[model samples]
Structures are given as structure tokens and as C-alpha cells.
Target: MTTVAAPTRRRGLFATLGDIYHERTNFNFIGRSRIWLGVSSLMVAISIGALLLIGLNLGIDFEGGTQWEFSVASGNPSSTQVREALKDTPARDARILTLSNGGVRVQSSELKTADRELVTQALSNYSKVDASAISIVSVGPTWGEQVSQKALIALLFFFILISVYLTFRFEWKMALASIIAVVHDIFITIGVYALTGFEVTPATVVAILTILGFSLYDTVVVFDKIKENQSTLGREKGDSYSSMVNRSMNQVLMRSLNTSFIALLPVISLLVVGSGILGAVTLRDFSLALFVGLLVGAYSSIFVATPILVILKEREPRFRALRDRSGPSVSAVAVESVVLDEENVMPAATPNPNDQRVTPRARQSRRGKRR
Candidate 1:
């Protein structure tokens, strides 16, 4: 019976650390299945398509509109009641969203002094029970537009600077791959907002940009391992570049999981606690997007970025030259030989210098010599 060798196990923290630093063997989740990778990439592409078609549901902060938040301690107010109260107000297309702590948030396209008064009076109906419960906060459309423009400019600058930095730190190909992954995460997060019709406030922009930075950091970690593995694996015989990349991904997979888990803890807390305490709907939007982006970011770094890179690099003439220069080419040749049955019935044999002519008696003599 044939037996298989067991895989080498990594032992001790120091050994594992050494392996990570030296780009030795490790395990990765995406490395286990190409089918999963194909599905994830397709999903990302679909998300991008949706974003391009419908665009994000930009909040008043982006397109210049007024936003108001009112705190009320009444019996839980319904959306219908809030709308009816402010029905005749100057503000057009008013929206009311319920908060976790039984408070209601009111927002509108734009507001005037008269509109504010009407809103105050309508809200006063609930305030009669608890006079100090309702508080109104408002931001002008001009300020919203300026904030939006600045946020967009900041995002553009961030993308350019990060791309340049990654190119310098790793390779241009890795940098491009990282950037594409970031774009994928961004579009998916934006699509989530659009599909669910979540408000895209200033806070949402901040969260998106933060996730972009995090995604880059994760991609860089994987690429750094790939770079090291490329150098080491090149020294060994029968190790393909694709195999080296797969090995590097496996090595860094644990690190990626640990990093992602640590990062997600805070974002999850913000999503749960910030909404309860802060009474800001924007917090939920921001945290949700960040959470989703982080997950997609980790996935892209492993599957999308590295696989795409292997596909690209393998196609290059330089890599082909390297493969050829590093190894000898084989040529086909033909030779004649003889075979003997168990009863020592020998097949016909031809004499050739490259082929051994073994007679049945000679085979017995060779077996005796081995014994």
C-alpha cells in the first residue's frame, strides 16, 4: 500500500513569526477554492454595475440641502404622525427616521425661517408632555455643499497618493491590484447604500475613506509576502511562480484574519453603541459600510488581487524568459528495448547503444547480482 506524507506543521510563536518574516509556508482561506474566488469577484462586479447605473443616494450634505435632528421623549412617534404634523410646512419632501432611544429625526430638502417655526410648533404638540425633550439642530445648504466638495477632493487625493505609495513600496503591478481592490470595495459599499436607500452623509464619506486606507494596508501585507516568496521560491527546482504566490497567500492568511478581527471589533461597537447613544443615523450608515468594506477588502487582497497578478505576470515575456533561462529544454527521442514475461518468455529485442538488451538469462543474472 502507498502512504502519503503528512504536511509539516508550524510550531512555536517564534517559528511561526520566522516563517511569516521569511515568507515560508502558511495557509489561506481563498487558496482553498478557486470557485469561491470567481463568485466573489462576480459579486463585486455586479455591485459596481449597480453603482454605475443608479449612483449613490447622496445625502443633503452632498447636493446642498438642509438637515435637522429633533429629540422627542413622547410615546414612540410613527412616520405617519410626524409627516402629518409637518404636512403644510415650507420644507418639501420631509423625512423622519426613528432612533434607537425612541427619538425621531427629521430631515428635509431645504428649510426657511417660516418652515422652522411650523416644525417647532408641530413638534411642540409632543413637547407638551416633556417640555425640554425636543431640540432642533440645522445646517445650511451652502455649508453642506462646501463640505461635500472638500470630502470628494480629499477622497481623490487619497486615492492618488496611496496608489503612488503602494507602487513605490511594492511593485507597480501590486499597486494597481491594490487600487482595483479598493475601487471594488468602494463601489460595493456605495451600491449597498443606493440599493437600501441609506442616506450618504458626511460621516459616510469618512467611513468609506477610512476603509480604503484599511484595505490598502491589508493588500500591502499580502503583497509583501508574495514579493519575498518570489525571491525564495525562484531558487528551488520545480516550483512554479503560481505555486509560490499560492504559498505566500497561505502564509499570510492567518495574519489577515487576526488583523481583520481586531479592526472589526471597534467598527461593530460603533454600529451598535453609537446609534444608541449618539442619536445619529449617520453613525449606522458609516459603520455598516465600513464593516462590509473590511470583509470585501480582505477577500480581494487574497483572491482578486493575487490571482489577477499571477494571470498578468505569467503572460509577460520577461517571466517566460526567466522560466526558460532557469531550466533546460527537453528533446524527444526513440529507443528499442526487450521485455520478458514471468515464465521467462522474452519479446524480440533490437541492439541499440542507448537501450539495454536484456535476455531472460541475463535478467536472472542481474536479479542474482542485486540479491
Candidate 2:
């Protein structure tokens, strides 16, 4: 007795995860660009709304304040109680937070020496500790305002330099697309923070700047591939500029995913272990900002950047002619039919030989050759 051959359908580990590392997917990024645009627009609108309505919970770094630091030895005071105690003093708008390391941070408006003493006394009474256990950090409003102005200036300069560099490397269309994607990432990240009421601190500002660089890197990767493909192999018959952009994104899809995932792993670990477990608020803030920004940055790079590039490039005389001839309704379908060869990993559009009609002369020639 003999066994039958195993079915070819059975695949190993690499084949199961969408073959993401090995095979290219024919996902029509540009075909579904309208959906992406709609989603991004809606997100941007919601983000803008949150920013307008809720605003960020600015930390002492951004909004000048008087901070009274203390650790509880025995008892605790609720934020409401602390605020009530300070209501009669200059630290009237006191906000209290329980630190992760079993500590208490009392942030408030500027306090006079007398008010400060009153706060210390109140905290001492609440915590059952001596008044000497209090620590104070007072930042002038001028410093906070200056920091804010400097951050804005840095962001502005970053945009200008990035635009110039991208324009030089790729083209104005790609530069525009990348800028739009970066802006989308920024607004989405900021909006999420605003909506969540996360404390916006100097660490958060640093994270945001870092996110800008990460987003630009992702955008440039996609753009670089698109530029190379468009210049080299995009002249194939029945291929549209939109499809080429989509194809380029697919080519480097796994690379972007891997890079983002690798980057996020440590950030997530810091958020969970270093921040949550170890009571590192700075790590929490930085990692949280990075987590949101990296995700949004990846999304905008693939969906927003390439799609906008296609839309912009399609307005050009060459691409306009191509679009007119291919027709929008049918071009995407045509592009989808062109499969990427698995073995060669390149675009294939050779017409089916069987689909060609054999005329009388051709049939005679074939019969003669056969004989």
C-alpha cells in the first residue's frame, strides 16, 4: 500500500502570517484612498474639535506653577481636600496627584511665603508629618511661556527644513504628500492627548519632536520606493500612477511594519514596566506620546502620503493623459489583475497568449509548422 501525495495547500509558518515577509500583497492603497482620506479627515476634525473644546492638560512645565512635593508616611489627603485647604490661600487652584512611588505631588498657582507655609502646615497635618518634610519647586510664568514659544519655533523650523529636503530628494508632489502625512500624524497625536487629558509636559514636547522625525522617515521610505518604481517600471501598458504608488507601498509594507513594531516594543515596555510598575512619570509621558505618534505616523505614511502623491501627480499632463485613457473606473481593476510574480517578485502584465485570436494566415503557418 502506498500513500497519496500531500496537498500543496499545506504551508509552513512564513506562509501563514499573510506571507508578509516573503510575498507581496495586491492591496489597492490608491484604489481605496478615498476611504483613507475620509477616515483621516474625520480623525483630523475630531482631533481639532477635542483640541478646541477640551484642550491639553498643561503640566507645570508649560503652565507656570508652584509645586509642593511630599511623601506620605502614614495618612493621605485627597485632591479635593487639598484644594479646599488651599482655597483660602494663593495656591488656590491646587491640583493633587498621587505619584506611583507612594508619593504625593501638589501642584498649584504661585504662593506667597505665608500661603506656602499654610500649605506646608496643611500637608503636615494631613500626612501626620512635620512641616519640614515639604519640598517646593516654583517656576516663573515667563519661563513656561518662553519654553512654549521655543517649541513652536522648533516645530516650524523642522517643517521648513524637511520640506526643502524632501523637495530636493524626490519632488514637490512627494514633499507635499509627506508634509500632509506628517501634519496628519501631529494632529492625531495631539488630539488623542487632548481628548485623554494627558499632562502635556516638556518630555511630551520632546516626544512629539521625535515623532516628527519618525513620521518623516516612514513617509520618505514609501516615497523613495514610489519614486524609484515610477521612474523605472511605471511605463507599463494599462498601469496607472495611482497603482504604481500602491504597488510601491506594498513593496515596503512589511519593512515599515517591522520597523514600527521594533520601535514600539521598547516604548511599550517602558510604558508598562518602567512607567506603570516603577512609577516613572517621565517614561510614561514620553512613551505614551511615542506610542500614539508612531502608530499614527505609520498609518499616515502609507495611506495618506502615497494617496495624496497619486492625486497630485495625476494632475500632471503625462499622468492626466494616462488617467484619461485608462479611465478611473476601470484603471484600478486593470491594475489589480496584474499580479506580482512570487518567484521573481516583480510586476507582470504580459497579455495572455491564449487570448490572442489566430487569423487564417497564422493558423496556416501553425499547421504548416506542425506538419
Candidate 3:
């Protein structure tokens, strides 16, 4: 008997691309892992509960308070000692924080003109402090409330506009998924503030909005790619909508990473260098939120938005058909063989028996002429 050799398997371009796409679909970090989603969601719930109970610690910008920064000689002056020295001042709700350089910063709520003078006089008891170092900044409570309202309005408007635009540009499924991802990033950022007890200010609000915009931009890019792939791959056999979406997401994953890295550079710099050079606490707060939000946004774009979209699109009839057609047993061979002619070649017209039909009058005339 003669021995026969088995044919070696050859991979095609589409097969290689499909393997890459399928490999990305199983990403445990950002893919639809039940364990990760459950853990993250539980943490998010805890953070939300803490936020509800404690709320945000609104800063002078939002609560209408006075803040004074004094640079005293570096002598490890305790916060308690500073507070005690300024106890005689006529400012209520006073707080003293120790600066990195052993200096002191004081913040108080509602001080009169003479009260400011008394604060200055009281600070003289501490180590050599210049009078000009005690500059006071104040705002009225009514103005603070107005600022708070405007911030809320702007956020609401931003969300509404984003939702409408996403829906128009892509689909309602994508819009809903993007908005949910936004909410996820926002809540996590706010929760970090609540858990760490960071002061929320106008600049913080700006940072939050900026993060939302960045997150939405990232999600939109992914969704736009998904939309293109959906239109192009809708008729593909043995490929469900879910698979197409996953493929689209994988294709753009690198682009998302590159974009996020570029955006995070400046934010990280502000967090590190700006904080040290300028001694501006606001930069630290804003950058902290931005950094965390950026990370969460990237994650949410992949896990939250795409998974939710898969769930939503699966509800459609056409998607259901695609899903039914895309069974595990289904092979590329089957897909190609079934749709290859329609896809790569034109269909030949079949002769119709009814096409030979003529009007009754013409048939009757023909019969009479023949007779």
C-alpha cells in the first residue's frame, strides 16, 4: 500500500485577522469578565454610598469662604499650634493645614474687615510672618450657590447634548452605552474625592468636564469604527453582530491607547511637577481626578460601552438572525460557500415560465389570424 500525505493547512488574510480579533475579544482586563465587572460595580456602589452619606467637601470656590496662605519659617509648626494661635481671631469654622515646607495655610468662613485685621495681628504670635503674606480671598454664599447651580446646569447640558449627538451619529445603543460609561467615570472620580476627602472646587469641576469630554471622544472614535464595521459586515455569514463589534473594537484598541497616552502626559506632569513648582493645591486635585478618570474612561470604553452595546443590539431582530447564523459549528468555509457567489460574483437570471405570458387580446388576435 502507498502512503499518502495529509494536506497542510494554509491560513488566509481574513483568517489571520479573525484570529487577532478573536484573541482580543477574550481580554480579561477590559473585556466582559463577570468577576471584574462585579468587583468594580461593588466598589462603585460603596463609593456612591459614601458620597451620599458624607457628600463632597465643597471648597471656598463653591462654599463662599475665605482662604489665607501664610509662609512662616520652617519649624515644624503643628496644625494644632497654628489653630490655637489664631483662636482669638473672629473667624468661625477655622481650619489650619501644615504646608510641605512647614508653613501654615488657614481657611475660615465669613470674616469681617476688622476680623481680617485681628487675624493678621494674631498671626504675628507665630514665627516671623509678613503682613502681606496674609492675603484673604472671600466670596458670598449666594454667589457660591449660583456657581454651584451653573456647574450642575453645564454638566446636565453636556450629558444631554452628548447623548443626542451620539444617537444621531451612531445609534441609540451606542449613545446609551457612552453615557453609561461617562456616568461610571464621573462616579468613580467623585467617589475617590469622597473617600480621600479631597476638596471639590470649580477647577475640579472643570477637570471633571474635561475628563468627560475626553472619555466621550474616545468612545466616539470606537463607536464610529463599530458603525462602519456594522454596515460593512452586516451581510457577512457566520459573523454575528457581537463578533463584528468585538472585531471593530480590537482594530481601534491601539489607537485608543496611543491617544490616551498622549492626553495623560500633560495631566501627569501637572500632578507631579506643577504641584511641586507652583505649590498650587488645585493643580494636584485637578490632575488627580484627570488621571483616575482617564484610566477609568479607557476601561469603560472597552468593557462598559461595548458590552452594553452587545446586549442592546442583540435585542434587535436582525441581530438575532445574525446571532443564530453565527454558531460555533459554523465555519469560514460554510460562510464563504453560502454567500460567496452573492458577494464575489453576480447572480445569473433564472428563466420564468410566466415571462412568456401575453395579453388575452393579443392571444385571441393571433389565434384568429392563424385561423
Q: Residue 6 in model 3: shift from native, Å?
A: 20
Q: What lDDT tens digits, residue by residue, belong to model 3 across residues 1-371?
A: 22344434444557544544444322222233355467668768978998999888788778887777777655677877777787666753487766655566677887788887788767765757767766678887888999999999999999999989998888788899899889988999999899888778888899999999999999998888888887776566677777777667767876887889898999989988876666678787789889989988887887777777877888899888887877752222222211121223333456555566556754344354444
Give per-residue CA lDDT, model 1, range 150-178, as digits (tens): 99798889889987898888878877777
**Relative to the true structure, how large is the alpha-carbon lDDT of every model?**
0.70, 0.80, 0.75
**Runs of candidate 3 exceeding 4 Å displacement:** 1-33, 328-371
Candidate 1, superposed: residue stretches over 4 Å from native: 1-37, 49-55, 126-133, 276-282, 321-371
Model 2 Cα lDDT, one tens digit per residue, 1-371: 22344323333444435656764466667777898999999999999999999998888877887888777776554667666766766666677887788777888876677877887887777676688878888887988999999999999999999999999998888888888998898999999999988788999989999999999999888888887888754367766677677777778988999989999999899889988999888898899999999999989998888888888888898887777676563334733412331333334455554675657754344354445
Candidate 2 local lDDT, residue 9: 33
lDDT of 1 at 200: 83
- RMSD of every candidate to native, in Å, equals 11.1, 8.8, 15.3
Candidate 1, pairs of clashing residues? 26-250, 26-251, 27-250, 28-250
TM-score (C-alpha) between model 3 and the true structure: 0.77
